[model samples]
Target: MTNPADVKVAVVGAGGKMGTRVSNNFAKSDYQASYVETSPAAAERVKDAGRELTDLETAVSGADVIVLAVPDIALGPVTETIAPMLQQGSIVITLDPAAAYAGLLKTIDGVAYLCAHPCHPSVFLERTSPEQWADTFGGQAAPQEVVAARQSGTDAQQALGDEVIRCMYGPVIDVHWVTVKQLAQLEPTLVETVGCMVGQFLKDVMDHAINEVGIPEPAVKAIFYGHVYIALTNALRGSNPFSDACLLAMDYGREAVIKDDWARIWDDEDLDRVLAKMLRLEKIER
Candidate 1:
């Protein structure tokens, strides 16, 4: 086992959103960590956090893991520059799977490529403190799961990669291993496309009800919030059998709101299409 003290981890673009979140945990960890950023604004943020920023080359030198915490669109050019400079057996960790799955990340024979995304704090989390309640995004107080993929390199490299992953995303409950393609699918397809879209759609319709339909806002929200929990528990957990009338209403709602061929989002072509749009690329090649 590689000791955490011996592991040299460098976070590139160390002042961005995801960068700052993970850097907070790494700062409290035993791993020797380096922060790197080129933008003056970001570099100042790093400095304000009392972390000395290292230049890209100095930070990547002999580093066991180089975390590219930059944006998805920047991954191709960023990896093109950094991947070849990595020492043998180093692992490159990306926070998102889009670029890695789309083949935008550069490849090197001896270096491992990994993508790890946090699942965030669950709605069902058993929170007992103000801190946990405030940490809806996890990594601070609330425990969360992670989904990760190792795209290359040996078992030892992966083990160390796992350690770094758990460290940076501390308070993590579990790390579910999946293929790079599977990780990509879980993200934009399952979570963003379906889950987030549904959430936003709910808010939109709620607004329509209160504003256009002339329903009382307090009454609508009172019924909606409570029913939301019951609906999820009944459908997802089978906590209680939905009344027969409720089932008919649900069936009608499904037919009215959901398309018959909505499952086509699972198709690989559709995944590639969405990934391209998300990454602002012409198309994902493969």
Candidate 2:
């Protein structure tokens, strides 16, 4: 019988944004954890958080799981330095799938590469407490789901990674397993390419109404906010059907705003191009 408490976990870049969040959760878990950060400022942050810092080599030497919470662009060099030091059968968890999907991470022979991403609190989450409502990014009071991918590992390794993933992102609803490529498609493709662009476009159009059309800000906000909520509910959950006039207007808006080839973002070549831009690489090998 394996005791999870015996598992040594190392969080690289422990004082970074994602690193700090997970390290805070790991503080409350049973696993033996190490915080490693090379930046003097970040190291000071770790100390301020009451966590002792360990050297990178020493941290990866005996770690059962190594969480690289560093940014996507830094994943290559960070993992390259730590890969040789990783213990056999150790799991290297990246916070995002971009580097992994682009084949930028240094490969270790017997080590597993797992990428686990937080979905954050959903728009439709039934948040009750003030704390839950305040935790828009989750890993706090609000419950959220995680999407994970194991690029290389056994079933047992994935199961262990799942446990670690859940612990790092506490108050998690579930962990949905997918391949690294699928996870990449879900993130930069589905979330950033489509969702975030639409969100920003809404702001752009709203500003256009206020600035260009000379609509009063308060009037525009009151009507637009209400309609946005209703639009989401009606379109996503079918809570109510759009009126015939509203449908016609929506069709006009769609034709006017969206490109005919907008769905091309889902294509693999486009995804690779997007990832290359994000990772600051000339091209993605895989």
Candidate 3:
């Protein structure tokens, strides 16, 4: 039997928003986590969230499972850095499953990789508390009706993924799985759509709060609804079809809408200052 308790998780983006949430959830869950954030402040935050801290090499080298919580653009380099560091037989998991990343992950030898959630929960307005998110977006099982559809149309693994549609989001739902072959073709559009909507909404919030600068509220609601609903549906569609093309296409569309230049609205020199102000986050660079 697989011992769920034996899982030793290492989170690579412990200092960021999504990393913190993932660290917190894992802390509350039964698994053990070695939280990794390059920033000491982010590392400290992970410790405060009740997880341990370690550098990239040490974390992946000793971990049974490694979770990359970094931004989508950073995944390629980050994964390449850690691939050689990982212990034999260790499994790697990426929150975003875009084809570019999935293709990169497949290049790693002797490690298992899985593409799970495409979007982070903070995008949802309803997710005010970690508990609310834990309860609502936790996990789910796919419906039976989709089973036969998958069986005749695809392979067993593909059908199994289809069976997990129901549990895609709550404590009532369980974790879903898909192969690298499948994940590679999917995930891009889903991440792009979700990330773009959140970015745009955040942009709007920042614009309205230019005077307040850091304290944003209200508009965060629309951001969450539009972002999460769109992402979840795409995830379901991709993971169920056991194909990644549709999701990739969506990501392409979203990227075309808002590329990194969006960060330019705030001058480059003051970008850090702007982010600190908008998120009410204290700069922890020591």
TM-score of each: 0.97, 0.96, 0.50
Clashing pairs in 2: none
Weakest ten-residue segment in model 1 by summed lDDT: 82-91
Score each candidate by Cα lDDT. 0.91, 0.93, 0.53
Q: Residue 208, candidate 3: how far off, in angstroms?
A: 14
lDDT of 2 by residue, 1-286 (tens): 3466999999999999999999999998888999999899999999999999999999999899999999899999998888779899999999999999998899887888999999998888999999999998999899999999999988888989999998899899999999999999999999998889888988999999999999999999999999999999999999999999999999999899889998898889999999999999898886
Candidate order by decreasing lDDT: 2, 1, 3
lDDT, candidate 1, residue 161? 85
Question: Candidate 2: which stretches are off by over 4 Å?
Answer: 1-3
Best by lDDT: 2
Q: How many pairs of residues in model 3 come into backbone collision?
A: 21
Question: What number of backbone clashes does candidate 2 have, counting pairs of residues 3 or more apart or in separate chains?
Answer: 0
Residue lDDT tens for model 1, 105-139: 88899899989999998888899999999998999
Model 3 TM-score, 2 decimals: 0.50
Q: Name the runs in model 1 displaced over 4 angstroms.
A: none
Ranking of all predicted structures according to TM-score, beginning with the best and ending with the worst:
1, 2, 3
